[model samples]
Target: MRTPNASRAALTLAALFLATLSLAALPAGVQARSSDRGKPMLINADDADHALDESQPTVLSGNVVITQGTLDIRSARADVTTRNNEPTRVVLTGSPARLKQEMDDGSPFSANASRIVYDLTSDTVTLTGNVTVNQRGNTMNGPRVVYNMKTGRVQASGTGTGSGNGRVSMRIEPKNPTPADESGND
Candidate 1:
Protein backbone atom coordinates (compact mmCIF):
# COMPACT_ATOMS: atom_id res chain seq x y z
CA MET A 1 0.00 0.00 0.00
CA ARG A 2 1.19 3.53 -0.85
CA THR A 3 0.03 6.90 0.30
CA PRO A 4 -1.24 9.50 -2.21
CA ASN A 5 1.75 11.77 -1.61
CA ALA A 6 4.10 8.86 -2.14
CA SER A 7 2.43 8.02 -5.42
CA ARG A 8 2.73 11.64 -6.56
CA ALA A 9 6.38 11.68 -5.65
CA ALA A 10 6.98 8.48 -7.60
CA LEU A 11 5.28 9.93 -10.63
CA THR A 12 7.44 13.02 -10.46
CA LEU A 13 10.56 10.95 -10.16
CA ALA A 14 9.55 8.82 -13.15
CA ALA A 15 8.99 11.90 -15.27
CA LEU A 16 12.37 13.29 -14.31
CA PHE A 17 14.06 9.99 -15.10
CA LEU A 18 12.48 9.88 -18.54
CA ALA A 19 13.58 13.42 -19.27
CA THR A 20 17.11 12.61 -18.23
CA LEU A 21 17.12 9.51 -20.38
CA SER A 22 16.10 11.50 -23.45
CA LEU A 23 18.83 14.06 -22.81
CA ALA A 24 21.46 11.38 -22.38
CA ALA A 25 20.50 9.40 -25.47
CA LEU A 26 21.85 11.93 -27.95
CA PRO A 27 24.74 14.35 -28.16
CA ALA A 28 24.03 17.79 -26.84
CA GLY A 29 23.26 20.85 -29.00
CA VAL A 30 21.41 18.85 -31.64
CA GLN A 31 18.22 20.43 -32.94
CA ALA A 32 16.39 20.87 -36.22
CA ARG A 33 16.05 24.27 -37.85
CA SER A 34 13.37 26.16 -35.96
CA SER A 35 11.89 27.78 -39.06
CA ASP A 36 11.28 24.49 -40.78
CA ARG A 37 8.07 23.84 -38.89
CA GLY A 38 6.52 27.08 -40.03
CA LYS A 39 7.28 26.44 -43.69
CA PRO A 40 4.77 24.72 -45.91
CA MET A 41 5.45 21.04 -46.65
CA LEU A 42 5.67 20.13 -50.34
CA ILE A 43 5.36 16.55 -51.57
CA ASN A 44 5.92 15.14 -55.04
CA ALA A 45 5.56 11.61 -56.36
CA ASP A 46 5.13 9.65 -59.58
CA ASP A 47 1.58 8.75 -58.62
CA ALA A 48 -0.71 9.81 -55.79
CA ASP A 49 -4.02 8.44 -54.52
CA HIS A 50 -5.76 11.27 -52.79
CA ALA A 51 -8.49 9.81 -50.63
CA LEU A 52 -11.85 11.52 -50.57
CA ASP A 53 -12.70 10.40 -47.08
CA GLU A 54 -10.93 11.94 -44.12
CA SER A 55 -10.37 8.55 -42.51
CA GLN A 56 -8.53 7.16 -45.52
CA PRO A 57 -4.84 7.73 -45.92
CA THR A 58 -3.34 9.50 -48.97
CA VAL A 59 -0.90 7.21 -50.68
CA LEU A 60 2.08 8.33 -52.75
CA SER A 61 4.05 5.70 -54.62
CA GLY A 62 7.11 5.61 -56.84
CA ASN A 63 9.93 8.08 -56.16
CA VAL A 64 8.20 9.93 -53.39
CA VAL A 65 9.84 13.19 -52.35
CA ILE A 66 8.84 15.56 -49.58
CA THR A 67 10.34 18.86 -48.57
CA GLN A 68 9.79 21.58 -46.02
CA GLY A 69 12.16 24.49 -45.75
CA THR A 70 15.62 22.95 -45.47
CA LEU A 71 14.26 19.49 -44.69
CA ASP A 72 14.05 16.83 -47.39
CA ILE A 73 12.88 13.20 -47.44
CA ARG A 74 12.90 10.59 -50.19
CA SER A 75 11.35 7.14 -50.37
CA ALA A 76 9.81 4.68 -52.78
CA ARG A 77 6.38 5.08 -51.19
CA ALA A 78 4.71 7.28 -48.61
CA ASP A 79 1.37 7.20 -46.82
CA VAL A 80 0.07 10.43 -45.39
CA THR A 81 -2.57 10.77 -42.70
CA THR A 82 -4.53 13.94 -42.19
CA ARG A 83 -6.81 15.29 -39.51
CA ASN A 84 -8.99 18.35 -39.89
CA ASN A 85 -7.64 18.74 -43.42
CA GLU A 86 -4.04 19.00 -42.13
CA PRO A 87 -1.34 16.37 -42.40
CA THR A 88 -0.80 14.62 -39.09
CA ARG A 89 1.64 11.92 -40.04
CA VAL A 90 3.66 10.43 -42.90
CA VAL A 91 5.02 6.92 -43.21
CA LEU A 92 7.73 6.32 -45.79
CA THR A 93 9.10 3.00 -47.00
CA GLY A 94 11.83 1.93 -49.39
CA SER A 95 14.90 -0.21 -49.71
CA PRO A 96 16.20 2.60 -47.56
CA ALA A 97 14.20 5.72 -46.98
CA ARG A 98 16.36 8.81 -46.52
CA LEU A 99 15.92 12.08 -44.69
CA LYS A 100 18.03 15.24 -44.47
CA GLN A 101 17.56 18.52 -42.70
CA GLU A 102 19.50 21.57 -41.56
CA MET A 103 20.14 21.82 -37.87
CA ASP A 104 19.51 24.91 -35.81
CA ASP A 105 23.20 25.82 -36.01
CA GLY A 106 23.30 25.39 -39.82
CA SER A 107 24.94 21.97 -39.66
CA PRO A 108 23.60 19.14 -41.78
CA PHE A 109 21.58 16.28 -40.26
CA SER A 110 20.72 13.11 -42.10
CA ALA A 111 19.31 9.65 -41.54
CA ASN A 112 18.55 6.48 -43.48
CA ALA A 113 16.39 3.47 -42.70
CA SER A 114 14.15 0.87 -44.31
CA ARG A 115 11.11 2.69 -42.93
CA ILE A 116 10.56 6.19 -41.53
CA VAL A 117 7.56 7.64 -39.82
CA TYR A 118 7.11 11.37 -39.28
CA ASP A 119 4.47 12.49 -36.80
CA LEU A 120 3.66 16.13 -37.32
CA THR A 121 1.50 16.45 -34.25
CA SER A 122 4.24 15.09 -32.03
CA ASP A 123 7.11 16.59 -34.03
CA THR A 124 8.88 13.25 -34.01
CA VAL A 125 10.60 11.15 -36.64
CA THR A 126 11.00 7.41 -36.04
CA LEU A 127 13.26 5.22 -38.13
CA THR A 128 13.41 1.46 -38.05
CA GLY A 129 15.40 -1.33 -39.70
CA ASN A 130 19.10 -0.58 -40.16
CA VAL A 131 18.81 2.95 -38.85
CA THR A 132 21.74 5.29 -39.23
CA VAL A 133 21.78 8.94 -38.28
CA ASN A 134 24.46 11.58 -38.70
CA GLN A 135 24.74 15.15 -37.47
CA ARG A 136 27.81 17.23 -38.14
CA GLY A 137 30.49 14.54 -37.96
CA ASN A 138 28.85 12.44 -35.26
CA THR A 139 27.15 9.22 -36.20
CA MET A 140 24.76 6.71 -34.60
CA ASN A 141 23.70 3.32 -35.87
CA GLY A 142 21.06 0.96 -34.57
CA PRO A 143 17.94 -1.01 -35.44
CA ARG A 144 15.66 1.86 -34.51
CA VAL A 145 15.99 5.59 -33.87
CA VAL A 146 13.44 8.11 -32.71
CA TYR A 147 14.10 11.83 -32.87
CA ASN A 148 12.00 14.58 -31.35
CA MET A 149 12.37 17.56 -33.62
CA LYS A 150 10.94 20.02 -31.12
CA THR A 151 13.10 18.96 -28.17
CA GLY A 152 16.08 17.59 -30.07
CA ARG A 153 15.85 14.39 -28.11
CA VAL A 154 17.03 11.16 -29.71
CA GLN A 155 16.46 7.62 -28.53
CA ALA A 156 18.05 4.66 -30.31
CA SER A 157 17.98 0.96 -29.62
CA GLY A 158 18.86 -2.35 -31.25
CA THR A 159 18.29 -6.05 -30.91
CA GLY A 160 19.24 -7.00 -34.47
CA THR A 161 22.40 -7.03 -36.57
CA GLY A 162 21.65 -3.67 -38.09
CA SER A 163 24.56 -2.14 -36.20
CA GLY A 164 26.81 -5.03 -37.25
CA ASN A 165 26.62 -6.80 -33.87
CA GLY A 166 23.02 -6.58 -32.74
CA ARG A 167 23.83 -3.51 -30.67
CA VAL A 168 23.49 0.25 -30.86
CA SER A 169 26.59 2.29 -31.55
CA MET A 170 27.48 5.97 -31.61
CA ARG A 171 30.56 7.96 -32.57
CA ILE A 172 30.43 11.50 -31.25
CA GLU A 173 33.18 13.85 -32.40
CA PRO A 174 34.88 16.28 -30.06
CA LYS A 175 34.19 19.97 -30.40
CA ASN A 176 36.39 21.92 -32.79
CA PRO A 177 39.58 23.19 -31.19
CA THR A 178 40.12 26.92 -31.20
CA PRO A 179 42.83 28.22 -33.52
CA ALA A 180 46.08 29.45 -31.96
CA ASP A 181 46.47 33.22 -31.72
CA GLU A 182 48.62 34.41 -34.65
CA SER A 183 49.83 37.49 -32.71
CA GLY A 184 51.87 35.28 -30.33
CA ASN A 185 50.39 37.00 -27.33
CA ASP A 186 51.12 34.95 -24.19
Candidate 2:
Protein backbone atom coordinates (compact mmCIF):
# COMPACT_ATOMS: atom_id res chain seq x y z
CA MET A 1 0.00 0.00 0.00
CA ARG A 2 1.16 3.51 -0.85
CA THR A 3 -0.11 6.96 -0.03
CA PRO A 4 -0.94 9.59 -2.67
CA ASN A 5 2.28 11.50 -2.17
CA ALA A 6 4.30 8.33 -2.05
CA SER A 7 2.68 7.08 -5.23
CA ARG A 8 3.31 10.38 -6.94
CA ALA A 9 6.89 10.36 -5.82
CA ALA A 10 7.36 6.86 -7.07
CA LEU A 11 5.88 7.75 -10.42
CA THR A 12 8.13 10.77 -10.68
CA LEU A 13 11.12 8.67 -9.84
CA ALA A 14 10.19 6.13 -12.46
CA ALA A 15 9.75 8.81 -15.06
CA LEU A 16 13.04 10.35 -14.09
CA PHE A 17 14.76 7.04 -14.40
CA LEU A 18 13.43 6.50 -17.87
CA ALA A 19 14.26 10.02 -18.96
CA THR A 20 17.84 9.65 -17.81
CA LEU A 21 18.26 6.98 -20.46
CA SER A 22 16.23 8.40 -23.33
CA LEU A 23 17.00 12.10 -23.23
CA ALA A 24 19.17 13.51 -25.99
CA ALA A 25 20.46 16.96 -25.00
CA LEU A 26 19.13 20.16 -23.54
CA PRO A 27 20.17 23.77 -23.08
CA ALA A 28 22.40 25.04 -20.29
CA GLY A 29 21.31 25.99 -16.78
CA VAL A 30 19.10 22.94 -16.77
CA GLN A 31 19.51 19.40 -15.54
CA ALA A 32 21.17 16.93 -17.86
CA ARG A 33 18.64 15.68 -20.35
CA SER A 34 21.04 13.63 -22.41
CA SER A 35 21.90 10.10 -21.44
CA ASP A 36 24.23 7.31 -22.52
CA ARG A 37 21.39 4.90 -22.96
CA GLY A 38 21.82 4.12 -26.63
CA LYS A 39 25.52 4.77 -26.75
CA PRO A 40 28.12 2.06 -26.98
CA MET A 41 29.41 0.79 -23.65
CA LEU A 42 33.11 0.13 -23.49
CA ILE A 43 34.94 -1.56 -20.65
CA ASN A 44 38.68 -1.64 -20.00
CA ALA A 45 40.42 -3.67 -17.35
CA ASP A 46 43.96 -4.59 -16.44
CA ASP A 47 42.87 -8.18 -15.99
CA ALA A 48 39.69 -9.87 -17.24
CA ASP A 49 40.47 -13.42 -16.29
CA HIS A 50 37.03 -14.93 -15.74
CA ALA A 51 34.39 -16.70 -17.69
CA LEU A 52 31.28 -14.76 -18.72
CA ASP A 53 27.94 -16.41 -18.23
CA GLU A 54 25.13 -14.80 -20.10
CA SER A 55 22.64 -15.75 -17.42
CA GLN A 56 24.92 -14.72 -14.57
CA PRO A 57 26.80 -11.59 -13.63
CA THR A 58 30.22 -10.94 -15.17
CA VAL A 59 32.87 -9.75 -12.82
CA LEU A 60 35.76 -7.54 -13.97
CA SER A 61 38.68 -6.84 -11.72
CA GLY A 62 42.02 -4.98 -11.65
CA ASN A 63 41.49 -1.35 -12.59
CA VAL A 64 38.18 -1.54 -14.34
CA VAL A 65 37.05 1.42 -16.39
CA ILE A 66 33.72 1.86 -18.11
CA THR A 67 32.81 4.60 -20.56
CA GLN A 68 29.83 5.58 -22.60
CA GLY A 69 29.43 8.98 -24.18
CA THR A 70 29.93 11.58 -21.44
CA LEU A 71 29.67 9.10 -18.57
CA ASP A 72 32.86 7.63 -17.11
CA ILE A 73 33.22 5.18 -14.24
CA ARG A 74 36.29 3.69 -12.60
CA SER A 75 36.64 1.08 -9.91
CA ALA A 76 38.88 -1.68 -8.63
CA ARG A 77 36.27 -4.28 -9.51
CA ALA A 78 32.83 -4.39 -11.14
CA ASP A 79 30.08 -6.95 -11.53
CA VAL A 80 27.95 -6.43 -14.61
CA THR A 81 24.64 -8.11 -15.27
CA THR A 82 23.51 -8.31 -18.82
CA ARG A 83 20.19 -9.01 -20.46
CA ASN A 84 19.98 -9.83 -24.13
CA ASN A 85 23.55 -8.67 -24.75
CA GLU A 86 22.97 -5.36 -23.01
CA PRO A 87 24.05 -4.37 -19.52
CA THR A 88 21.14 -4.14 -17.11
CA ARG A 89 23.06 -3.43 -13.95
CA VAL A 90 26.55 -2.84 -12.65
CA VAL A 91 27.96 -3.14 -9.16
CA LEU A 92 31.25 -1.32 -8.72
CA THR A 93 33.60 -1.69 -5.77
CA GLY A 94 36.85 0.02 -4.88
CA SER A 95 38.61 1.90 -2.14
CA PRO A 96 36.34 4.59 -3.52
CA ALA A 97 34.74 3.95 -6.86
CA ARG A 98 34.46 7.10 -8.95
CA LEU A 99 31.88 8.30 -11.45
CA LYS A 100 31.80 11.48 -13.52
CA GLN A 101 29.43 13.04 -16.02
CA GLU A 102 28.54 16.31 -17.66
CA MET A 103 25.24 17.78 -16.55
CA ASP A 104 22.78 19.49 -18.85
CA ASP A 105 23.53 22.77 -17.07
CA GLY A 106 27.11 22.52 -18.30
CA SER A 107 28.29 21.68 -14.82
CA PRO A 108 30.54 18.78 -13.95
CA PHE A 109 29.22 16.09 -11.59
CA SER A 110 31.23 13.53 -9.73
CA ALA A 111 30.81 10.96 -6.99
CA ASN A 112 32.87 8.55 -4.93
CA ALA A 113 31.80 5.55 -2.89
CA SER A 114 33.14 2.25 -1.72
CA ARG A 115 30.33 0.47 -3.51
CA ILE A 116 28.10 1.73 -6.29
CA VAL A 117 25.20 -0.15 -7.74
CA TYR A 118 23.68 1.09 -11.00
CA ASP A 119 20.43 -0.48 -12.08
CA LEU A 120 19.50 0.17 -15.66
CA THR A 121 16.13 -1.46 -15.45
CA SER A 122 15.07 0.80 -12.60
CA ASP A 123 17.26 3.67 -13.75
CA THR A 124 18.55 4.26 -10.25
CA VAL A 125 22.03 4.63 -8.80
CA THR A 126 22.80 3.65 -5.22
CA LEU A 127 26.03 4.49 -3.44
CA THR A 128 27.09 3.03 -0.11
CA GLY A 129 29.96 3.39 2.35
CA ASN A 130 31.37 6.88 2.63
CA VAL A 131 29.39 8.19 -0.28
CA THR A 132 30.17 11.65 -1.55
CA VAL A 133 28.66 13.55 -4.45
CA ASN A 134 29.75 16.84 -5.98
CA GLN A 135 28.06 18.98 -8.57
CA ARG A 136 29.90 22.10 -9.60
CA GLY A 137 30.64 23.68 -6.20
CA ASN A 138 27.98 21.90 -4.19
CA THR A 139 28.87 18.84 -2.14
CA MET A 140 27.05 16.12 -0.23
CA ASN A 141 28.39 13.44 2.07
CA GLY A 142 26.69 10.50 3.69
CA PRO A 143 26.95 6.79 4.36
CA ARG A 144 24.42 5.90 1.70
CA VAL A 145 22.86 7.79 -1.21
CA VAL A 146 20.39 7.06 -3.92
CA TYR A 147 20.49 9.35 -6.93
CA ASN A 148 17.99 9.70 -9.73
CA MET A 149 19.90 10.94 -12.75
CA LYS A 150 16.81 12.03 -14.61
CA THR A 151 15.20 14.13 -11.88
CA GLY A 152 18.47 15.03 -10.17
CA ARG A 153 16.97 13.84 -6.91
CA VAL A 154 19.23 12.53 -4.17
CA GLN A 155 18.36 10.62 -1.02
CA ALA A 156 21.04 10.25 1.63
CA SER A 157 21.28 8.51 4.97
CA GLY A 158 23.68 8.84 7.89
CA THR A 159 26.33 6.31 8.81
CA GLY A 160 24.59 5.32 12.05
CA THR A 161 23.16 1.85 12.35
CA GLY A 162 19.92 2.84 14.13
CA SER A 163 21.95 4.49 16.90
CA GLY A 164 20.69 7.90 15.68
CA ASN A 165 24.10 9.49 16.12
CA GLY A 166 25.21 9.68 12.50
CA ARG A 167 24.38 12.65 10.34
CA VAL A 168 24.49 13.56 6.66
CA SER A 169 26.33 16.72 5.65
CA MET A 170 25.86 18.94 2.62
CA ARG A 171 27.14 22.22 1.30
CA ILE A 172 25.27 24.14 -1.37
CA GLU A 173 26.73 27.30 -2.82
CA PRO A 174 24.56 30.28 -3.61
CA LYS A 175 24.29 31.48 -7.16
CA ASN A 176 25.72 34.94 -7.69
CA PRO A 177 26.53 37.18 -10.60
CA THR A 178 30.00 36.83 -12.07
CA PRO A 179 32.39 39.77 -12.57
CA ALA A 180 31.07 40.30 -16.06
CA ASP A 181 27.51 40.41 -14.81
CA GLU A 182 28.36 42.79 -12.00
CA SER A 183 30.12 45.19 -14.37
CA GLY A 184 28.45 46.36 -17.54
CA ASN A 185 30.43 46.39 -20.80
CA ASP A 186 32.15 49.71 -21.51
Candidate 3:
Protein backbone atom coordinates (compact mmCIF):
# COMPACT_ATOMS: atom_id res chain seq x y z
CA MET A 1 0.00 0.00 0.00
CA ARG A 2 1.48 3.35 -1.09
CA THR A 3 0.24 6.87 -0.49
CA PRO A 4 -0.37 9.18 -3.50
CA ASN A 5 2.56 11.38 -2.55
CA ALA A 6 4.83 8.37 -2.22
CA SER A 7 3.85 7.15 -5.65
CA ARG A 8 4.49 10.61 -7.11
CA ALA A 9 7.88 10.76 -5.44
CA ALA A 10 8.81 7.34 -6.80
CA LEU A 11 7.81 8.40 -10.29
CA THR A 12 9.89 11.58 -10.01
CA LEU A 13 12.91 9.64 -8.84
CA ALA A 14 12.57 7.18 -11.69
CA ALA A 15 12.33 10.01 -14.17
CA LEU A 16 15.47 11.62 -12.80
CA PHE A 17 17.39 8.35 -13.01
CA LEU A 18 16.33 7.80 -16.57
CA ALA A 19 17.29 11.32 -17.54
CA THR A 20 20.70 10.97 -16.00
CA LEU A 21 21.31 7.63 -17.66
CA SER A 22 20.30 8.81 -21.11
CA LEU A 23 21.65 12.34 -21.38
CA ALA A 24 24.39 13.42 -18.98
CA ALA A 25 25.41 16.91 -20.02
CA LEU A 26 29.02 18.02 -19.61
CA PRO A 27 30.17 21.42 -18.50
CA ALA A 28 29.56 24.52 -20.58
CA GLY A 29 32.06 25.85 -23.17
CA VAL A 30 33.14 22.37 -24.16
CA GLN A 31 31.45 21.17 -27.31
CA ALA A 32 32.50 18.99 -30.18
CA ARG A 33 32.82 20.45 -33.65
CA SER A 34 29.31 20.95 -35.02
CA SER A 35 30.38 20.82 -38.65
CA ASP A 36 31.67 17.25 -38.22
CA ARG A 37 28.09 16.00 -38.06
CA GLY A 38 27.44 17.10 -41.62
CA LYS A 39 30.55 15.47 -43.06
CA PRO A 40 30.61 12.13 -44.85
CA MET A 41 31.96 9.14 -42.94
CA LEU A 42 34.80 7.20 -44.52
CA ILE A 43 36.04 3.81 -43.33
CA ASN A 44 39.20 1.92 -44.22
CA ALA A 45 40.16 -1.57 -43.25
CA ASP A 46 42.14 -4.56 -44.44
CA ASP A 47 39.11 -6.88 -44.43
CA ALA A 48 35.38 -6.36 -44.51
CA ASP A 49 32.23 -8.50 -44.63
CA HIS A 50 29.06 -6.90 -45.86
CA ALA A 51 25.85 -8.81 -45.27
CA LEU A 52 23.26 -8.99 -48.02
CA ASP A 53 20.62 -7.61 -45.71
CA GLU A 54 21.16 -3.94 -45.15
CA SER A 55 20.01 -4.22 -41.57
CA GLN A 56 22.69 -6.72 -40.68
CA PRO A 57 25.93 -5.42 -39.28
CA THR A 58 28.90 -5.01 -41.58
CA VAL A 59 32.15 -6.18 -40.02
CA LEU A 60 35.48 -4.52 -40.61
CA SER A 61 38.72 -5.94 -39.27
CA GLY A 62 42.46 -5.43 -39.20
CA ASN A 63 43.65 -1.88 -38.78
CA VAL A 64 40.25 -0.33 -39.14
CA VAL A 65 40.25 3.43 -39.43
CA ILE A 66 37.17 5.58 -39.72
CA THR A 67 36.95 9.31 -40.23
CA GLN A 68 34.33 11.99 -40.66
CA GLY A 69 35.47 15.58 -40.92
CA THR A 70 37.80 16.13 -37.96
CA LEU A 71 36.63 13.05 -36.10
CA ASP A 72 38.90 10.02 -36.40
CA ILE A 73 38.70 6.53 -34.94
CA ARG A 74 41.13 3.64 -35.01
CA SER A 75 40.54 0.07 -33.94
CA ALA A 76 41.51 -3.50 -34.69
CA ARG A 77 37.94 -4.45 -35.53
CA ALA A 78 34.64 -2.69 -36.02
CA ASP A 79 31.02 -3.75 -36.37
CA VAL A 80 28.93 -1.24 -38.25
CA THR A 81 25.13 -1.28 -38.30
CA THR A 82 23.25 0.50 -41.04
CA ARG A 83 19.77 1.76 -41.68
CA ASN A 84 18.88 2.43 -45.31
CA ASN A 85 22.53 1.85 -46.24
CA GLU A 86 23.68 4.62 -43.92
CA PRO A 87 25.62 3.71 -40.81
CA THR A 88 23.58 4.08 -37.64
CA ARG A 89 26.11 2.74 -35.18
CA VAL A 90 29.66 1.44 -34.94
CA VAL A 91 31.19 -0.75 -32.26
CA LEU A 92 34.96 -0.80 -32.19
CA THR A 93 37.24 -3.16 -30.29
CA GLY A 94 40.96 -3.37 -29.89
CA SER A 95 43.70 -3.84 -27.35
CA PRO A 96 42.60 -0.27 -26.78
CA ALA A 97 40.46 1.47 -29.34
CA ARG A 98 41.18 5.13 -29.99
CA LEU A 99 39.20 8.18 -31.03
CA LYS A 100 40.17 11.79 -31.65
CA GLN A 101 38.29 14.84 -32.80
CA GLU A 102 38.54 18.60 -32.94
CA MET A 103 36.24 20.53 -30.65
CA ASP A 104 34.29 23.60 -31.69
CA ASP A 105 36.80 25.80 -29.88
CA GLY A 106 39.70 24.18 -31.80
CA SER A 107 40.94 22.16 -28.84
CA PRO A 108 41.57 18.45 -29.38
CA PHE A 109 39.48 15.71 -27.76
CA SER A 110 40.69 12.15 -27.54
CA ALA A 111 39.78 8.87 -25.88
CA ASN A 112 41.06 5.33 -25.59
CA ALA A 113 39.30 2.22 -24.33
CA SER A 114 38.98 -1.51 -24.78
CA ARG A 115 35.58 -1.09 -26.43
CA ILE A 116 33.92 1.91 -28.01
CA VAL A 117 30.36 2.32 -29.25
CA TYR A 118 29.43 5.17 -31.52
CA ASP A 119 25.71 5.73 -31.93
CA LEU A 120 24.94 8.00 -34.83
CA THR A 121 21.27 8.41 -34.04
CA SER A 122 21.99 9.69 -30.57
CA ASP A 123 25.26 11.33 -31.54
CA THR A 124 26.99 9.76 -28.57
CA VAL A 125 30.18 7.79 -28.04
CA THR A 126 30.45 5.34 -25.15
CA LEU A 127 33.85 4.10 -24.03
CA THR A 128 34.20 1.16 -21.69
CA GLY A 129 36.86 -0.93 -19.93
CA ASN A 130 39.75 1.16 -18.65
CA VAL A 131 38.63 4.27 -20.42
CA THR A 132 40.75 7.41 -20.64
CA VAL A 133 39.52 10.68 -22.05
CA ASN A 134 41.48 13.88 -22.69
CA GLN A 135 40.06 17.21 -23.72
CA ARG A 136 41.22 20.82 -23.43
CA GLY A 137 44.28 19.64 -21.46
CA ASN A 138 42.10 17.88 -18.88
CA THR A 139 42.10 14.09 -18.46
CA MET A 140 39.60 11.64 -17.01
CA ASN A 141 40.19 7.99 -16.25
CA GLY A 142 37.48 5.54 -15.36
CA PRO A 143 35.86 2.24 -16.16
CA ARG A 144 33.28 3.83 -18.46
CA VAL A 145 32.76 7.16 -20.18
CA VAL A 146 29.99 8.48 -22.38
CA TYR A 147 30.43 11.48 -24.59
CA ASN A 148 27.62 13.27 -26.35
CA MET A 149 29.06 14.53 -29.60
CA LYS A 150 26.31 17.01 -30.29
CA THR A 151 26.21 18.65 -26.90
CA GLY A 152 29.85 17.94 -25.99
CA ARG A 153 28.66 16.65 -22.64
CA VAL A 154 30.70 13.90 -20.99
CA GLN A 155 29.73 11.46 -18.24
CA ALA A 156 32.21 9.16 -16.57
CA SER A 157 31.67 6.39 -14.04
CA GLY A 158 33.57 3.78 -12.10
CA THR A 159 32.96 0.05 -11.54
CA GLY A 160 30.50 0.69 -8.71
CA THR A 161 32.25 -1.59 -6.28
CA GLY A 162 34.45 -1.19 -3.24
CA SER A 163 37.24 -3.48 -4.35
CA GLY A 164 40.17 -3.19 -6.71
CA ASN A 165 40.37 -0.03 -8.80
CA GLY A 166 36.69 0.80 -8.79
CA ARG A 167 37.19 4.53 -8.86
CA VAL A 168 37.20 7.39 -11.37
CA SER A 169 39.85 10.07 -11.49
CA MET A 170 40.41 13.34 -13.27
CA ARG A 171 43.19 15.89 -13.74
CA ILE A 172 41.87 19.29 -14.76
CA GLU A 173 44.37 21.91 -15.83
CA PRO A 174 43.78 25.45 -14.66
CA LYS A 175 42.54 27.92 -17.21
CA ASN A 176 45.03 30.51 -18.41
CA PRO A 177 44.21 34.16 -17.86
CA THR A 178 44.21 36.68 -20.69
CA PRO A 179 46.72 39.50 -20.58
CA ALA A 180 45.36 43.04 -20.23
CA ASP A 181 47.65 44.66 -22.85
CA GLU A 182 46.79 42.38 -25.78
CA SER A 183 44.74 45.18 -27.45
CA GLY A 184 48.01 46.70 -28.70
CA ASN A 185 46.68 50.28 -28.51
CA ASP A 186 50.10 51.52 -27.33
Q: Which candidate number would show the highest lDDT if scored against the true structure?
A: 1
Model 3 regions more than 4 Å off: 1-30, 33-41, 83-88, 119-124, 147-155, 160-165, 177-186
Query: Against the hidden true structure, what lDDT does model 2 obtain?
Result: 0.62
1-186: candidate 1 lDDT, tens digit per residue:
333332232222222212222323345765667787677556667887665555777777899766778877778987767676666676778889877777778887777789877777787777788877776677888888777868877777776434455668988777785777999984
Candidate 3 per-residue lDDT over residues 135-162, each given as its tens digit: 7667888888777767857777786323
TM-score of each: 0.65, 0.64, 0.64
> What would the per-residue lDDT of candidate 2 be over residues 1-186, giving only the tens digit for each residue?
333332232223223333332221223445542665456556677765333345566666899776666677778987766665556676779999877767665677677878877777877778788877777577777787777765767677885434455568887666673555445664
lDDT of 2 at 65: 70
* TM-score, structure 3 vs. true: 0.64
Q: What lDDT is obtained when candidate 3 is compared to the true structure? A: 0.65
Stretches of candidate 1 off by over 4 Å are: 1-31, 34-41, 119-124, 147-153, 160-165, 177-186
Worst 10 residues of 2 by lDDT: 18-27
Models, CA RMSD each = 12.5, 10.4, 13.5
Best TM-score goes to which candidate? Answer: 1
Which has the higher lDDT value, candidate number 2 or candidate number 3? 3
